[model samples]
Structures are given as structure tokens and as C-alpha cells.
Target: MFYQAKSTCLYCDHKFTTTKVRMSKTKVLKRDSDFCIHYDGPNPLFYDITICPECGFAFYNSYRKLSDHQRKKLKEAYISKINVMNMVGERTIEEAIHTFKLALLTASIVNERKFITANLSLKLAWLYRMIEDEAEELRFLQNALDDYIYMMAYEDIEQEEVDEDRLIYLIADLNLRLGHYVDARRLFSQLITGKQVSPRYKSLAIDRWQDYKEELEDGD
Candidate 1:
């Protein structure tokens, strides 16, 4: 009987040892030839001995591979559900930020509808601002703004429509939050001049715009 060594099955997490009985292929006279091995009894799940970096299992799927298609779709679905959650609740903020980022990544991969793309971009920007990723926050907000503006003016319409004004201020608010004062001030001023945003938010945006400009000038 051949001696067996115990090891963790990296693929499925089954703990076991190789059976004592084994068969090995004859080594080819040629050196460096591919070696073939045969085993008896329950075949240990292929389970690579090498560890999986992302998942921490020797053969288990990496996070990327585990999430490849279905997990991403699930993330998108979760994000879709949390879209209606307001900002005030205990779990709301966490859920919003998580789903928003997931949606942004998934939307980029899936070629979803324009609003999903637009809204995810907007939500991701806001989430980044909340977490203090200022540069990333502005970059995403600008992207959302571009997506919304392009969609509102033109871009395969008939699929869906939304409150463009709300989106405009949402983007502006993101900029304000991110300390992109010049950009925020410009957008808020334009929206206020056109009365394009809701009165309440527009007033808030204007106030923020003024504050942002003040900070800018003081800093200068």
C-alpha cells in the first residue's frame, strides 16, 4: 500500500487523504515529457494544490471568476432594488453606496439601458463623495452628467425618460460635495438661471455654489 498524505480539497472544501493504492504512468525516455498519472478510488476533486489568491482556496474560484456573470447580474438586481431607498435610514446609506457602485460596474459590463447607466453613474458619484473619494466622486459625477445630458438631448430615446432637472442638480450637488467648487458653482448658477432644477434643491445648490466660490476665492 502506498502511503497517503492528507490535504484540503481546495475546490470543494472536502477534507480527505489520497487512497493508498495508486498507479503512475511510465516515464517517457524523453526528458520533460508530459507526465500522466492514474488513481484508484474516489478521485480527489481536481482541486489544484495551488491556492486561489482571491478566494484563499487552493482551487476554489477566484472572486472574479466566482462573480463573473451571474454574481454581477445579481449585484445589478440588488442595485435596482435599492434605488428607491432614501438617505436617512440606518442601512440605507450602506445599501445605497454598495448597490450604486455595483450597478456602475455591472452597467459598464452589461450594456444596459441609458438611464441605468446614467443613474448608476450618478449614484456612484454620490457614494464616492459620501466616502471622501473626492477625485473619483467628481469623475463619476461628471460622467453621469455627461450621460444624462447626452441622453436628454439625444440618445436612443423611447426606451425611457426621467426627471433630467433632478439629475442635473444631483450632478451639481456631487460636485459641491467633492470640493470641485468651480465646476459646481458653474452648474448650479446655470441651473438656477434657467430655473431648471426644483426650487428647493436649486436654492440649496445656489447657497452651496456661493459657499464654494467663497472657499475658492479664500483659498486663492
Candidate 2:
């Protein structure tokens, strides 16, 4: 259910092979509200980040080629310090987490966009959730929430091709998961009432809000 794919490292231009799950062979079991997908076979999420053994640069398919400054900074701050491990083979959950952490570090070093950071944090949170590590999951969820908020406040959603309503919904859902009920309710309301928002997100917001209220009432 896995195949090796050849990839060129963005930082050092090193050609290497990385393992990937054959999506055609995998079956979707369920998808969480947070968009964590459960697959019947090997999870493709685990193989999303590719680490180059030559320079220790970790990245995903969406990552762009680095500038000279970023390359220099990475060499001084990241590549020179850590011993690059050969992670080209099939990755375990622990190995995937390790690669994701490295990618997060590299993303920070180059000042990668907020959306990308948010996505990486969210995936890390999902990975932690898979291991039943609630503390780490919440921590990364908080990180993702913060990054998403920053993106909305300062970044250009249109240019980034990000759906604004979807981002808002995610922020709201993350707030709910993190127990920020007041903020979650407010955001859910925003999505529900915004005229420009898509009906899909609006319906989703209403469903989540209603379910939350029902849970509260049931508990009481």
C-alpha cells in the first residue's frame, strides 16, 4: 500500500526517495470535524512530509523553493546542527511526528506563511490525537488556532486561494474543541449570519452549534 516517490529537496536540491501511501488502495473510514481522515490501511497523512537525508530539510509538496537567504539561514540554524536521518522508508507514527516537528522548525526558520504553519500544526495535532496524547493535541491545536487567526487578520486570503468562511469555521471549531465556548459560539454565529458565506459552512456551523447546545442541556 506504499510506494517510493522521487523528490528533490527544496533547500539543497538533493534528489531522494520518499515513501507514500497508495491512496487508491486505501479506504476512508471516517473524517473528523477537524478534517483528520481515518483510513482502513496505512494513513496517507503520515507520509505527507518528506525529509531529505542530505541537508535535513523537511517539507511537503506545497512548499516552494527557498531563497538564498532562507538557504543560508537554514544551513546556519538547522542543517548544520542536526544529523540528517534517512527517513526515505515507510514511516511509523513516531517517525512521522519527528518529521513533522522538523518540518515545523524549518517552516519557522524561513518564515513560511501562516496558513502553511497552521496546516502543519493541525496535522501534528491530528497525529497526537491518533496516539491518544490529549495534552500535545491541545497544544498543537492552540498553535493552529493562533496561526489561523493571524492569517485572517493580516494575510490576503484571496491571493492565497483560501476560503475565508472555511477559515473562520475552522477557527470556530478549534475554539470549541479547546473549550473556548464563548468564542466558539460567537464565531459560529458569525458564520451562520454572514451574507457572503457559503451555505455549506453555514449549515455546518448551525449543526455544530446545535450539537454543542444539546450536549450542554443533556449534561444538565
Candidate 3:
């Protein structure tokens, strides 16, 4: 399931080989209602971020191409600031989390879109969750939820056409987890009653909303 693929750093043009997981080799053990994947084989999540050994420019699939200004910033801020050579080779789960953290830092440095930052943060949270590190998991989850809120409220997110329903469901679910029951109920109600929401998400939202009401009743 693992294969070595050649990657050229967008910032430095440094060529390196990185490991990638073949989808065929992975079996999904389960999925959290929030759509987090639990894999039976080598988890593909660990290998999503590619770190350029020579330049320390870490990125993921969404950031393969870079503008000239972005490249300059990465070279100056990322390459000059870190020990790039230390990140080469196979990554342990801890090392994988490190790479994602670095990617988040770089994303922040470049003023990346809120959606990308939130996604990277969420992935880091998921990685921490995989290791059962509750503190780190909650920390990153909160970061992600905050960014998701900003993206919805202030930023012009393109996902409005792509997966807005899914995004709404995510916000609702995150609110529920973070104990924002009123906001959760509001978003969940929107998803459940909206005409365009997918049947799958609608069904899931209905179930989660019922559970939330029961929890509220129990709290009373």
C-alpha cells in the first residue's frame, strides 16, 4: 500500500521521495459520525503532509502549487527558521503530528484561507485524538471550530457551492461537542429542515438533534 513518490518542493525546487498510501490497501474500521476515518491498515492520515527535507516547506494536497510571493515567504520564514534536515524519512505518529503543526504554522505565516487553516488544525486534532491525547485534541478542535466560525461569518468561503450542507453539519456537530447546545440546535434544525441538504446528512442531523433534546431534558 506504500509507494515512494517523487516530490519537488514548490519553494526551493528540492526533489525528494515521500511515502504515500494506496487507497486500495486501506480498510475503514469505522467512521465517527463527524466523518473521521478509522483505518484498519496503515492510516493514510499520517502521510498527508509532505515536508521538504531541504527547505522545511511543509504542505498538503491543497497546497501543491504556490505563488511566487508564497514561495518567497516560505523560504524566508520556514526554511531559514527551522532545522529542515531533521524532518526527513519515515514519520512516527508523533512526527506526523509535528509535520502537520509545521504545515499549520506555514499556513498561518502566509495568511492562508480560513478553511485551509481550519482543516489543518482539525487534522492535527484528529491525530492527537488517535493517540488519546485529550488535551491536545480539544485544543486543536477548538481552534478548528473557531476558524470554521470565522470562515462562515467573515470570510467568503467558496464551499458555499461545493459542500455548504456538509459544512453546516460540521459546525452543528462541533458546537454540540463543545457544549454550545443552543447554536448546535439551531444549525441542526437548519440542516434537518433545509430543502437542499443531502438525505444522509439530513438523517444524521435528525438523529443528533433528537439526542441533543434528550440530553437537554436529562440536564433539566
Most TM-score-accurate candidate: 2
Structural similarity to truth (TM-score) of each candidate? 0.43, 0.96, 0.89
All models: lDDT? Answer: 0.49, 0.91, 0.83
**Residues 106-166 of candidate 1: C-alpha lDDT, one tens digit per residue:** 4455445556576556655545555578788768767776776667677654545455555
Q: After the best TM-score superposition of candidate 3, give how far the Cα of residue 126 lies from its true spot, in angstroms.
A: 0.7
Worst 10 residues of 2 by lDDT: 55-64
- Tens digits of lDDT, candidate 2, 1-220: 9898999989878887888999899999998887789887799998999999787789977776889999899999998899989998988899999989998999999999998899999999999999999999999999999999999998888988988888899999999999998999899999999898899999999998998899899999
Q: Could you give candidate 3's per-residue lDDT for residues 1-220 as a string of tens digits?
A: 7888888876778898888787888999998756779998788888888888777788876763678887687767777789865555566899989889988998887778788888998889889889999899889888999998999888776743437788889889888877788899899999999998899889999988887779879999
RMSD of each: 22.4, 1.1, 2.3
List residue ranges in candidate 1 displaced over 4 A: 1-102, 155-161, 174-186, 195-198
Name the lDDT of candidate 3. 0.83
